[model samples]
Target: MNYKPTLIFGRISIAISLLLIVSLLFIDCNSDRLADIKETEEILRKADASIQNSITQKNIDSLMSFYAEDACLLPTAEPKVEGKAAIKREWQHIFEIPDFNNKSTLTKIEISKDGSMAYTMGTYLATMQGEDGSPVEEPGKWVTVWEKQSDGHWLIVVDTYNTDIPPPDHK
Candidate 1:
């Protein structure tokens, strides 16, 4: 009845089935990870929007809440400021400028493959009173790094920005 050929054919079919199953499993896992990454991006987008709202409302504390306790701020024309206390002081100083106002728009928010970290690229328009007591506009781009906390909340670990305008001497 040629049972040897039938047996060999059965084994081949079983092997092919196993390979297909394994491939499908791998693809499914990757799809799940991709979905997670997309969801994380949305979370960051919402967070970015909330932080900008805090700025518009002039809520210093709310603005600071987005930062980690040991965050760092690399402000323009200054050395790096570390820790929440220092960052808060920097914000306070900026807030002190007469007629100070800022508006930020996020351009991109990229998530790490592991979904544990992310970074944001954004631009800002800031206005403050100059030495002549007239509103001075400062347009700048900023990049902020974020880490997802144990509570699933993302906080800024590093925030840095610089103006587009060149130095007076260079102008």
Candidate 2:
């Protein structure tokens, strides 16, 4: 047996094995990251569904439960509403409207790599009694920022929405 040939083959085999190990490690890291993203997405989806349910049921407490203590709400043509108490008050006012109905469909949700923060953009359709007690429908878009708390629950930290169509006076 030629010693040179044997040594060269042994070195090549070691290099190939190292490369495979590194590749496997990289793939495992990526797999974990993907799983985290999927989990975050699912959490956001469930939260969105719960929010819609609360709105449909006109449950102000349930709706406020989805928000963080320091959350902010930026409503259309209105000043920013901040904190849980303020947000609760805002929802209270809306829920008091006669025959108020609202629904939201999430279009996109993006989460950070660390799984600590996320943002969701969506569309909303709402119906409520107009001044004459007639049903009025308003279609709009919204964006919400979510943050993960120490309890491992995600809550909305910032929310904003605006109507797709301008008010009649604008036309």
Q: How does residue 77 of candidate 2 score in lDDT? A: 86
Q: Looking at model 2, which ten-residue stretch has the lowest summed lDDT?
A: 162-171
Off by over 4 Å in 1: none
Give the Cα error of residue 65 in candidate 2, in Å. 1.2
**Candidate 1 residue 123 C-alpha distance from true site, Å:** 1.0
lDDT (Cα, tens digit) per residue for candidate 1, span 95-135: 88889889899999888888898999999999989999877
TM-score of 2: 0.91
lDDT for residue 1 in candidate 2, whole number 0-100: 69
Best by TM-score: 1
- For residue 64, what is the lDDT in candidate 2? 88
Error of 2 at 130 (Å): 1.3
Best lDDT goes to which candidate? 2
Instruction: Give per-residue CA lDDT, model 2, range 52-135, as digits (tens).
Output: 999999888898899999999999989999999999998889899888898889999999878899999999998899999889
Off by over 4 Å in 2: 1-4, 167-171
